[model samples]
Target: MRNVKLIIEYDGTKYNGWQRLGNTDNTIQAKLEGVLSKMTGENIEIIGSGRTDAGVHAYHQIANFKTHSMMSVYEMRDYCNQYLPQDIVVKEAVEVEERFHARYNATSKKYLYRIWTGRIPTVFHRKYTYYIPQRLNVEAMRKAASYLIGEHDFQAFSSVKSKKKSTVRKIYAIDIHKEDSELNILFHGNGFLHNMVRIIAGTLIEVGLGKMKAEEIPEILEGKIRAQAGITAPAQGLFLYEVHYGE
Candidate 1:
């Protein structure tokens, strides 16, 4: 048996999420497994690096599965692409060690949240970016984001329904970049709880809008209450940029 690592990109508009639910009719994992089973004539289980919430897209999400097939990596990619939907694409595939598990072996993950601060909604970018009509003070947002960089108990930023026991996570970086009306926030972290990044983005936007002070971030973090944070931004504006694994 050989383990095959796949680099996948999906629009994530129609599917429920990355993971397969017994009752859910559609999912990214189920689709991939269906095509793989058809091609290999064997039932295959594909494990993803992480689960992206419904409507959250991915640029380079990784997954790995074990298979015993005579097909080459190049041929497997072609075969999978032919069977996969247009919104989902298998960008690349390669054989890896048998013990390599996508989720367990992942070192870090990078996510990007796009925001459009303009008077009118952008027709072309409406699907990918969150449109906020108010003029955001980017400098204030930057100052607020600084407090989030480093290891901290992020209970205030996580969703109330998160099942994770410990909310402490290390944020390696929090970067805010702007180009005209478009604003992008990139977050690099060891891991994130449910809706953590979205809540952080929403809280930062509040600071940018002058609703919250930059100095208030530390207080919120210390509060450890989910209600202390801002709204959870829509998942449509977020993307799983990439997952890292140490070689």
Candidate 2:
């Protein structure tokens, strides 16, 4: 058997997230598996790098599955795209070593959150960004972001419903950039808890809105209390930007 790694991109608006659910009629994984079974004549299981929440988009999500087919990478890509739905596309496909497990071998993940800080929302961007009419203090937000740049117990920033035993994760970088009326926050981390990025975005937004002091970020981190942080931002504004692995 040969392992095939796939680079996938999806809109994620209508599906029930990446994992295949028992009763769910729509899912990215299920769709991919369906197409793969049709193309390769085998019941294949596609393992994703990570799960993106419902309504969260992905630019370069990665997955790998074992198959015995002799199809070329280009042919597999084209065949999968033909059978897959319009919103989901296989960007690339390549054979990899049998030891390459998509989830366990992921070295880093990059996420992007988009914010629209204009008075009138742009029709074209309404689906991808969170529109906030109130003015934001960008400098304050930057200061708050600095406190979350290292390894720490991120219980305050994570969803209480997360089942993970450990909340300790290393954040490699957190960057806030602005262009025109759009504000983008990029997060590069070793791993993340459920809704961690969205909550961090919400807390930063509170700081930017002058509702919270930037200096309070450390206290919030130390507190490890979810209520001490700001609200969780909508998942629609977040994207699984990329996944990285060392050669």
Q: What is the C-alpha RMSD of each candidate to the true structure, in Å?
A: 1.3, 1.2
For model 1, the run of ten residues with the poorest summed lDDT:
158-167
**Candidate 1: tens digits of C-alpha lDDT, residues 51-162:** 9988899999999999988899999999999989999999999999999999999999999999998899989998789999999999999999999999999999998564
Which residue segments of model 2 deviate by more than 4 Å? 160-164
Worst 10 residues of 2 by lDDT: 159-168
Q: What is the lDDT of residue 83 in candidate 2?
A: 82
Cα lDDT of model 2 by residue, 122-231, tens digit: 99988799999898999899999999998999999998565558899999999999888999999999999989999999999999999999999999999999999999
